[model samples]
Target: MNNDERIHLLAKELIPLYDDLAADTRLVVEEHARTCKICNEELRRFNATFAPLAAKEEVEPNAEIKPFKKLQAFKALMVGLLFLARFLLIGLLVAAFDPAAPRLLGGNIIMFYFPLAAASLSILYFFYRKLWFWVLVLFDVFILFFLDEVIYYLLL
Candidate 1:
């Protein structure tokens, strides 16, 4: 096609004329329009035609939405509770196996595992999302098995 025909076709096919364009395609089109006056004019006209429609659809919110803040606070509370439960469960398991250990050392040991488990769970929670929830559970089981082995060796 001739340059004018090609420019017209490109203008019609441009994403800004219709829908969202891929970033790479948008860059290619924008670069071409920058160098070509006819294409630039065509794109300008396309944008001008649609700009009014886009502007008319804009709606200003009358009131700030507050429900999302409440939901976020609830999520934070649940995560805190989950960490606390994990620490307590780990402490109870360790205490059950080594009840004769001095309270000072026992408390220190439990504190160590609390941070370790919290770190592990935090990494799994952020990175894995819902797909690896069971992985955390399996990790707890593995920790329990390792503790059992340690207790058995120490007692023997």
Candidate 2:
């Protein structure tokens, strides 16, 4: 094809990339085919079409948005530990419900304390560094002792 035909070809090819280029682009293609028989007419027929497309307001990037980061394994470990403690509490409560064990030992309140202490300790450990973690462990031990006493009383 000639030079004009080539410009038309470029416009036709690039038309699909833009919406306005569809019908208007054909007009451009036809105009190129008619005028400038010598070819190399760089008058830029789609200059306005390209300008509006370029100037179109973009969906601005979320200024309030924060970048995503993966949660640390330690965090997940702590969560799992807490959940385990919860399950333990639930199991103990189930055991407590059995009437065969006597009201004192098998009561829900005493059983719940075991799991509560465990869960509390797990949470404390997860949030604290190595130095402060011993505090949670101590509390956990204290809860166990308290529960033991409750059981002992109930047995008597």
Using Cα atoms with residue i matched to residue i, what is each candidate's TM-score against the true structure? 0.34, 0.27
Candidate 1: give the clashing pairs: none
**Candidate 1 stretches greater than 4 Å from native:** 1-67, 98-128, 131-135, 151-156
In model 2, pairs of residues that clash are none
What do the candidate models score in CA lDDT, each in turn? 0.64, 0.57
RMSD of each: 11.4, 12.0
Residue-by-residue lDDT tens digits, candidate 1, 46-125: 77888798888777778565567776677667666666777687666556664455343445544566566666677657
The best candidate by TM-score is: 1
> Candidate 2, residues 82-136: lDDT per residue as tens digits?
6587557655754554445544543455556666765566666666556546855
